[model samples]
Target chain A: GQQVMQIPQYQHVQEGEDFTTYCNSSTTLSNIQWYKQRPGGHPVFLIQLVKSGEVKKQKRLTFQFGEAKKNSSLHITATQTTDVGTYFCAGPVGAGSYQLTFGKGTKLSVIP
Target chain B: SAVISQKPSRDICQRGTSLTIQCQVDSQVTMMFWYRQQPGQSLTLIATANQGSEATYESGFVIDKFPISRPNLTFSTLTVSNMSPEDSSIYLCSVELAGRYEQYFGPGTRLTVT
Candidate 1:
């Protein structure tokens, strides 16, 4: 089993501003996946970063995995109302097991 | 990816009562997991469900408290036994993808114990 932690449990940003959240794991991960859960909504699949030092982007959202595979980050450029939600980073243990260890998550509040 | 349909999306019950939440996946999976998300907080792993074997629960969780059942690959159930208000939270069921670093979750069952 692995433990992942996210910093700045809560964040508030104005519309058009930038926002970022970080996820750190106590143990090395095989891969990392990020998810978003809007208020009163189910968690939605967002993105996954596998390789070390890998960076991927979707529109204004950017995701990065640390070179050591022990940490990851999600950065948003020009935040909007739709970006309001709790973001979580999950670490998959290995190829054999399908269990994914999840981080506490960072709650983002976007104000227009 | 898998589509999950969970029953009893939300419920409010008195203290000492129990609740059973069901998770049904469209496709068969080798493994399934259960999680709990508290109010204004994050998700915590409850257990990993194996089709033919008993589930392996994480620390701070016990089978007597959170009894889980996996009768087959595509379905499972979790019962919160003799619950208290402290057990109020959202319960989610998920299945992981083989060789892929992802897990698809159900809509979640929100519980409110009074």
Candidate 2:
């Protein structure tokens, strides 16, 4: 079975500070997806990285996939209060598999 | 992305009781999955429900405890049987649309067993 691990289980930052969460998978993944879950809401799809060494950005959030496709990272520049939530990184159980194995996730708290 | 709706947003159940959670997708999908999330924990895969075949349970999750039925492509049901205090958690159903790798999750059912 494949496993995904995340670093910095919990993080608290000043309103204008930056934050980053790293994810590593026990096995190489075909693709990796990121999700955000608010305090009382369901997990929402954020972004998906398919190509190795790919980098994508959405507003202040930047996502990067390692060249080996076995790890990934999410960096938020200048976090705000609205950025408080848990970010989870998930990857397919196997090549072409629909089932995803999610990392423990990094809970972020932005202090205003 | 898919729009999923789950029934009984929240419920309180007694020990030994069973509660069935329904998941309805806005469109027909081929792959649907059930997940459990405890307080401040990551999402754990419970099972995979594909239309027309038996559900596949993950390691640590048994079919008898979390029975799932995919009667059609747009709907599925998960029943938590013989519940206990540990059974209390948020159950969510997600769908992976055909040809897409990303999955969309439902709002989830918040269940608390006494």
DockQ of each: 0.71, 0.92
Off by more than 4 A, model 2: none
DockQ of 1: 0.71
Highest DockQ: which candidate?
2
- For candidate 1, report its TM-score: 0.93
For A1-112, candidate 2 gives per-residue lDDT tens digits of 8999999999999999999999999999999999999998999999999999999999999999999999999999999999999999999999998899999999999999
- Clashes found in each candidate (C-alpha, N, C closer than 3 A): 0, 0
TM-score of each: 0.93, 0.98
For candidate 2, write residues B34-77 as lDDT tens digits. Answer: 99999899999999999999999999999999999999999999
Error of model 1, residue B66, in angstroms: 1.5
What does candidate 1's lDDT look like per residue over A1-112, in tens digits? 5678898799999999999999999887778889999999878889988789999999999999999989999999999999999998888655545667778889999999
- The 10 consecutive residues of candidate 2 chain B with the worst lDDT sum are B95-104
User: Once model 1 is optimally superposed onto the true structure by TM-score, how far is the C-alpha of residue B92 displaced, in angstroms?
Assistant: 0.8
Q: How would you class the docking of model 1? A: medium
Docking class of 2: high
